[model samples]
Target: MSTIVALSTPPGSGALSVVRLSGTNALKILKRLTSTLDFTPRTATLTKLHHPDSNDLIDEVIVTFFEAPHSLTGEDVVEISCHGSPSVVRQVIDASRNLGATLAGPGEFSLRALSNGKMNLAQAEAIRDLIAARTETAAKQAARQATGELSKRLAEFKTRLLDVIVVLESAVEFVEDDLPPTQTNQIKEWLLFVLSGVGALAESYQSGHLLRDGIQVAITGKPNVGKSSLFNSLMERDRAIVTAVPGTTRDTLSETIDVGGIPVVLTDTAGLRQTTDDVESLGIERAYRALNEADVVLLVVDGSVNADWHEAGLNSFDHKTQVVVNKIDLVQYGHSDLPQGILVSAKTGEGLDDLRAAILGAFRGSAIQADGLLVTNARHHEHLQQAKIEIKEALVALDEHRSEEMILAPLHNALRYLGEITGETTTEAILSQIFATFCIGK
Candidate 1:
C-alpha cells in the first residue's frame, strides 16, 4: 500500500501537535523533507524540516521513526511533532502529500494494524471505545478489552468447542470399527459448559451497554416542586433557570453528570401541570415525552404539600421511577398522608447523598466487579445471542440421538458466530461498518 499521513492530534492550536505516517515509503517521504540522512529507529530526533523542492524551512520539528514489523501498523512509520499552529500542520500535510503520501481515511491506521494481524477486531473496537469513553469505569473497561481480555476469553471458548467437535467427529467416523464410542451424556455435558460460558458473556451486555452509553434520568413533577433546584443541586451549578415564578422553565434543560463512575444525563423537564398558555403546553408535552423515554425517573414532589396523585399521575409509575420529596428543610415535622420518598432539601443540600446513591442504585442495580470482561458492543451482543441459539439447538439434536450430520450444522454455525466476535469469520461489510465509526487519525 502507498504511504498514508494524518494529524494524530486534535485540531487547533496547542503546545504541540503530532502528524503520523505509516506504510511502505513512510521513512522515504520523511527523508525527502529533512536534511538528516540517518535517524536511529525508535529514537526521537530534533531536526529541521524543509520543503522538498524549494528547500524552504517549514519548521523545526521532532521526528520519530519505527521500522516495519515492529510499529503500530506493523509497517515502517514516521511521526512529526511540530508546533501547534494550524498553518504549520497544514504545510507539513501538503508537503507529505506532494511527496506521494495520501491522507488517511477514518481509522485507516488502526485498520492497517488490524489487517496486519497486530490486533483483532475486538481490540480495534476497544481502542475506539477507549478514545470515546465518557467515564473512568468505561475507560477502564475499554482499556482492558483493548489489551486482549475479551480475546483471551473467546480463545478459550473456541479451544473447548473445537475439542468437543473433534471428539464428536471421531465418534461419527469410527462407529463401524471397534473404536470405543464417546458417550452422548459426556458430549452433552461439554456442550452445556460452552453454552453457559457464552450465556454469561452475552448477559454482561446489560451493564456493558449501560456504562458505554449513559442512562437518561428525567426529573418530573408539577410546577414549583423544586425540579430545577434539584437539577442544579445535583449538577452543582445553576444550569436550569430557577425563580419563584411558576413555569419559569418553559423547556427542558439537560446535562450529564458522573454518578459514582456511571454517567447519568440529568434532564430537568418543565413541571407537569395544567396550563392554557401555548408555550407552557408545549413545554409540558416535551416533559411528558422525556419522562416516557427516560431510563430512570426522579418524581420530585413538594414535601410541604399533601399527595396530589390525581394530578401527578402516580398510578402510571413504573419500576424505573423513584420518588424524591424536596424542601424537607421546611417540612421537618410530622406528615399526615404524604407520598413516600427520599426526603431532601435542595436548598440546604440535605439528603442529596441519598439521592445520588439512589440514582446510582436505580441504574446499575448491582456493582460490576472491577477488571471483569464486559461485552459492550451491540453487534457483539447480537452475534453472541445467535451463537447461544445455535448451541442450544445442537444440544437438542444431541439429546434426540440425531445423526452427526444433523448436529454438525448448528455446531458449525455456533463456531462461526463466535468467530465473528473476534473477526475470525467477520465479513468485509461488517468490518467497514465497525471501523467507520472511528475518528480519522486513529
Candidate 2:
C-alpha cells in the first residue's frame, strides 16, 4: 500500500494540530522532511520540517515515530504536531504529500489497523462511534467497545459455538444411532445456551443504538398545555417561548438533553389543533411530522383545566407515548376528569424528576444492563440475526433426528456469521462500508 498522510486533528487554528503519516514508507518521508536526528522508535523528537524539494522551512514541529508492527496500523507511522494555523498544517501535509505520501481517505488509518490485525472490526467501528458520541455515557460505551470489550464477549460466544460445531461434526462422522443420548442432550443444551447469548446480545442493540444515536421526542398537545414549559424544564433552559396566548409556539424547536444516561432530543412542537393562520398551520403540519417521526411522544395536558381527553388528542395511547399532566400547582385543590398520565407542575418544577424518570424508563426499560457488553452497530446486529437463524435451523434438524449432513450446513453457517462479527469472515465491501464512516486520519 502507498504511504498515506492527513490532518489528524480538527481543521482550523488551535493550540496544536496533528498530521499523521502511515505506511511502509512513513518513516522515510518523515526523515526526508526533518533534520538529521536520531529518530528513535516510540519517541517524540522536536525537529524542524522542511520541504523535500524546495527545502523551504515549513514549521517547527514535534515528530513522533512508531516502528512497524508496534504502531497504530502495525506499520511504520509518524505524527507531526505543528501549530494549528491552517497554513502551517497544510504546508506540513503538502510537504509529506510532495515527498510521496498520498492524502489518506476517510478512516484509512483505522482501516490499515484492521487490515494488519492490530484491531478487529468491532474495535474499528467503535473508534468511529467514540468520535461521534454526543453524551458522556455514549462516549463510555463506545470506549468500552473500542477497547475490545464487545470483541471479548463475542469471542466467548464464538468459542461455545465452535465447541457445539465440533460435537455435531463428530456426531456426523459417526452414525446417528452410534451417538450417545447424553451427547445429544449436551448438544441441545449448548445450542440453547449459545442461542440465548446471541439473542440477548442482539436485543441489546436497541438500547445501545439509542444511547449512541439518541431518541427524538416530540412534545405535542392542545394550545396552552405548557408543552413549551415542559420542553424548557427538560432542557433546564428557557429555549422555547412561553406565553398565555394560544399558538405561541408557531414552529417546532428542539434541543438535546441527557436523561438518565440516554440522549433525548426534546422537540417542542406547535399546538395540535385546527388553525386559520397560515403560519400556524404550517407549524402544525411540522408538529404532526415531528410527532410521526419521533421515537417517543410527550403528550402534555393542562392539569388545571377540565378538558376532554379527546379534544386534547390524548384519547389513544401507544407504548411510545407518555402522558404528562402539567400545572399541578394550579390544580392542587381539584382533580381533573382525566385521571391518567404522570402529573406534574411545569411552573414549580414539581414532578420534573418523575417526568425525567418516566421518559428514560419508557425508552430504556432495562434494554442495556450496567457494565454489560452491547452490540450497537447495525451490521453486527444483522450478522447476529443470521447466526441465530442458522442455530435455530440446526436445532430443528437435530429435533427431527435428521442426518448429520443436515445439521452441519447450518452449524457451519452459524460459525461463518459469528466470524463476520469478529472480522474473521468479513468481505472487503462490508469492511469498506464500515470504515468509510470514519473521519480521515482516524
Candidate 3:
C-alpha cells in the first residue's frame, strides 16, 4: 500500500492536532521531516519539523512512531501532535505530502487496518458509528459492538454452521460407499438450531435501530390544545413558542432528549386546524407530514373540552397513538374513565410523570428486555432477512428428501449473507460505500 497521511483531528482550533501517516514509507517520511531521527518506535519525542525542500525549522511538535504490524493500520505509523492552529496543521500536512505521502481518503486508515486483519469489518463499522454517534446510548452500543461482542457471537455461530456443513458434505460424499443414510431428524434438528439462533440475532435489529436512530415523537392537536406547551415540557426546555393565541406556532420545532437512556426526537409541530390563511394551511400540511413520518404520535387534547372524535384531522394518523389530555388540573378527571390515555397539566406540571411513563410504555411497553443483543443498522437488518430466506429454502429442500447437493447452494448463500455483516465475504464496492460515510483520517 502507498503511504497515506491525513489530519486525524476535527477541522478546527483545539488544544492539540494530530496528523497521522501510515504505510511502508511512514518511518522514512518522518525521518525526512523531523530533526529527531534516532527516536525509538512507540515512543513520543519532542522534535522540530523541518521543511523538506529548504531543510528549515517549521514547528516544534511531539511525534510518536509505531513499528509495522503493531500499529493501528498494521503498518509503520507516525503521528505528529502539533498546535491546533489551522495554518500549522496545513503546513504539517503540506510538508508531509511534499515528502511523498499521499493524502488519506475518508476512512482510509481504518480500512487499511481491516485489510491487514488488525480488526474485522464489523469492528471498523462500529468505530465509524461510534465517531458519528449523536447520543450516549448510541455511543455505548457502538462501543460494545466495536469491542467484539457481536463478532465473537457471530464467530461461534459460524463455527456451528461449518460443523453442519461438514457433516452434510460427508454424508453426501460417502452415501454410495455403504455409508448409512444420513439421519433426517438429526439434520433437521441442527438446521432448526442454527435458524433459531440466527433469527434471534436478526430480530434484535428492531430495538437496535430504535436506540441508534432514536424514535421520532410528533405532537399533534387542534389549535390552542397545549401541543407547544407539552412539547416544551417533554423536552424540559423552552424550545417552542408558547402563546395563548390559537395559531401562534406555524412551524415545526424539534429537539432530542434522552428518555431512559434512549434518544427521543420530540417535534413540536404547527397546530392542526382548518384555516383559510395560506401560510397557516402550509404549516398544517407540514404538520400532517410530520405525523405520518413520526414513529410515535402524541395527540394532545385539551381536557377542559370534550373529546371530538368526529374531527377529520384524527383520521390521518394510523400509527401507535397516545392521547395526552393536557390541562387536567382544570378538571376533576380520574384515570378510571380513560384507561389507556394519560392526563397532565403542562402549565402546572401535574401528572407529567404519568405522561412520560405512558410515552415510554407506548413505545417499549416493558416487553423489550435491555439485556438482549440488538442489531442497529439497516444494512445488517436486510442481510439478516436475506439469510433467513436462504435458511428457510434449505430447510424446505431437506423436507422434500432432495439430494444433499441441492441444499448446499442455499446453505452457502446463507453463510455468505451472514458473512457480509461481519465483512468476512465483502467486495471493494461495498467496503468503499461503507467507509465513505466516515470523516477523513478515521
Candidate 4:
C-alpha cells in the first residue's frame, strides 16, 4: 500500500497542528526528515524538523510513532506536532510529499483501520457521527455506538440467524436421505425467533433517525398570538423580533435546541392569516409547508383574547398538534383552572413547565426507547429493511413446505444484507459512498 499523509487537525491557526503519515515506509520517511534518533511509539519526543532538500531547520516539533498493526491504520504511523502557522503546515506537507508520501484522501485513516479489521463499519461510521454531533445527547449516543455497543448487538443477532441457517441447511441436505433431522415444529420456532429479533431492530431505525437528524418542530398560530414570544421563551433568548403589532414575524425563524436530551429544530413561523401584503403572504405559504413537515406543531393561542377555538381550525393540526395557551397571566388564569391544552404565559413565564412536560410526553409516548439500541444511519436502515424482506420470504417458503434449497437462497441473501451493515460483506461502491461523506483528515 502507498504511504498516505494528511493534516490531522482542522485547517486554521491554533496552538498546535498535527500532520499524520501511515504505511510501511512511514518510519523510513520520518528518519530522513528529522535528526533526532530517539523516536519511539506512544512517547512524545521533542525533535527538530528540517526541509529535506535544504536540510534547513523549519521548526522545533514533537514527533510520535506507532509500529505497524498497532497504529490507527494497522501500518507504521508518524504524527508531527508543530507550531500552527499556515506556512509551517504547508512546508511540512510539501516536504513529506517530496519524500514519497501521497496525500491522504477523506477519511483515509479511518477507512484503512476498518479495512484492516481493527474496527467494524458501524464503529467507523459512529466515529464520524460523534465528531459532527451538535447536541450533548447526540454526542453521547454516537460515542456509545463508536465504542461497539451497536456492533455487539448486531453481532448477537447475526449469530442467532447463522444458527437458524445451519439447521435449515442441514434439513435440506438430509431430508432425502435416511439421516434423522430436527422436527418441523422446532424449525418453525427457530425461524420465528430470528424473524422477531430482526424485526425489532428494523423498527428501531425510526427513533434512531430522529435522534441523529433532530425532530422538526413548528410554532404556528394566528396574528399576535405570542408565537414569537413563546419561541423566544423556548430558546431562552431573543432570537426573534417581538412586537405588540400583529404580523411582526413575517418570515420563518429557526433555531436548534436540546429538549429533554433530544435535539429539536424549532421553526417560529409567521402568523397564519389572509393578507394582501406580498411578504406576509409568502410567509404564510411557508408556514403551511413547515406545518406539514414538522414532527410536532405548537399551535399558540392567546389566553388574554377571547378566541373562537372552533373558528381557528385548532383541530386542523390533528395528532401532531399541542395547543399552547400563551399569556395566561394577563387573563388571571390559574393552573388548576386551566383548560385541556397546555397553559403558559410567555410574558410572566407561568405554566411553562406544563408545556415542556407536554413536549416530553409526546416523545416518550412513541415507540422509541430512550436507552434502546438505535440505528442512526440511513444506509443501515435501508439494509435492515432489505434484510427484513428477505427473512419474510424465507419464512413464507418454510411455511409453504417449499423446497429447502429455495428457502436457503433468501436466507443467504438475508445474511449478506446483515453483513453489509458491519461491512463483512460489501462492495467497493458502497464503501466509497460511506467514506465520501467524511471530512478530509478524519
Colliding residue pairs in candidate 3:
none
What RMSD does each model have against the real structure?
2.6, 2.9, 3.1, 3.4
Error of 2 at 62 (Å): 2.1
lDDT of 4: 0.83
Which candidate gets the maximum TM-score versus the true structure?
1
Q: How are the candidates ranked when ordered by lDDT, highest leading?
A: 1, 2, 4, 3
1-442: candidate 3 lDDT, tens digit per residue: 7999999999999889999999999989889997666878888899999889998777899999999899999999999999898988998889989888999999999999999999988888889888877677788888998888888887776776677688778877877743234666666777788788888888887678777787788888888889999888877778888889999988888888877667788988888777898999989998888888887888888887666733636665745688887887777666555424677899889888887666667766424434556777888888888888988998999888777788778888888988998898989999999999888998
Instruction: Please give the lDDT score at residue 103 for candidate 1.
Output: 98
- Stretches of candidate 2 off by over 4 Å are 53-56, 167-177, 241-250, 273-278, 304-309, 312-319, 330-339, 364-368
Q: lDDT by residue for model 2 over 331-383, one digit each (tens)?
A: 84655465589898888999999988887777556564435777778888999
**Stretches > 4 Å off in candidate 1:** 175-185, 274-285, 306-310, 313-319, 335-337, 363-371
Question: Which of 3 and 4 is the better model by TM-score?
Answer: 3
After superposition, candidate 4 runs with Cα above 4 Å error: 51-59, 83-91, 98-100, 168-175, 178-186, 243-251, 273-288, 307-319, 333-340, 363-365
| Backbone clashes, each candidate | 0, 0, 0, 0
lDDT by residue (tens digit), candidate 1, 367-442: 5433478898998899899999999999898877777767888988999999998899999998898888999878
Which 10 residues in a row give candidate 1 its minimum summed lDDT? Answer: 363-372
